[model samples]
Target: MQPLLYNMPTLFAALGIRLKQISRIRQETDDSKPHVVELQQVTAVQVLVKAGQHIRGEPVEDRINSEEVRRLLDEFVPEWEVREERLYRRFETANWRVTLMTANAIGFLSEAAYHHPRLVLNYRSVEVYLTTHDAGGLTKLDFSLARKIEETVGWPRSREEMPGRRPKEWLRS
Candidate 1:
């Protein structure tokens, strides 16, 4: 009799299949209802997987401290803020459409990176706060995501304009 030895790829494939089935079950249960709980769980799992891969050879104590964060911000993301354990930025647009577009860009980037941030969307402003809650502070992931967001949506150059006017011309460019 031979003992079973699971391969990493095989294990991952099996886990992926199980996750798909769970997702399908959630979808089949209710089409109209928002599966917020399930979505959050899946997102969290994805973030964990990504973070695990990212920190495979690194220690959690390597998380960026306030001084390091400030230095990094000064070099690349000067407009961003560091408060306590979080990195924050606010962007304003001229109209609701642009605001929504900016928010969607941030959402897409965050999802792809598996590093979600807190985004508050006002009528013409979007506030983003990034932190590695698991690490209990800022990490390389936070800065990476913030840089992506800055590149994707850019900083607002002017104040909010009329309701229908697009204030941030660079967003269109």
Candidate 2:
């Protein structure tokens, strides 16, 4: 019984997936805010270093700690074949929280990085790095990685309740 149950992910979704009705994902009307986008009906951001960023996104620190960033790289296990990257790290803490970002969102990140620090864009086939020493010697690679991961896992899949803390349905149109 235990082994069979463990193999079935839906069983966990029954007990694991706990939250509200998750009505719909709405965008904040106020432009003065930090581009607050909702997740429920849409994919809600799981974790934020500063939760308030939800209300008003803070200026991206533009600093990706080496050790910390490496740790996060562990979770986003990018699949070259699917061109999809999943959150491999736990979002329990900022030190360990993984953020995914992408190219299409460069403008937003450009502003977040103060539009100075050069960013590196890596393609699946060829990894590229564009580092600029002018805008304070620091790497914006974290933002790039975050954006990539975010774009890859867009629109969290719709799911119904199940047993354990397992996700059964990630199907989206």
Which of the numbered candidates is closest to the native, going by highest TM-score?
1
The estimated TM-scores of all candidates read: 0.58, 0.25
- Which residue runs of candidate 1 sit more than 4 Å off their true CA positions? 1-61, 155-173
Residue 34, model 2: lDDT of 36
Worst 10 residues of 1 by lDDT: 17-26
Q: Mark the 10 consecutive residues where model 2 has the least summed lDDT.
A: 89-98
Model 2's TM-score against the true structure? 0.25
For model 1, residues 36-131, the per-residue Cα lDDT tens digits are 212223332354445443444454535776788888889767779886568899887657877776786677557656566899999878999998
Clashes of each: 0, 27
- lDDT of candidate 2 over 56-91, digit per residue (tens): 334434444556545545554332111112112111
Residue 150 miss distance in model 2 (angstroms)? 4.5
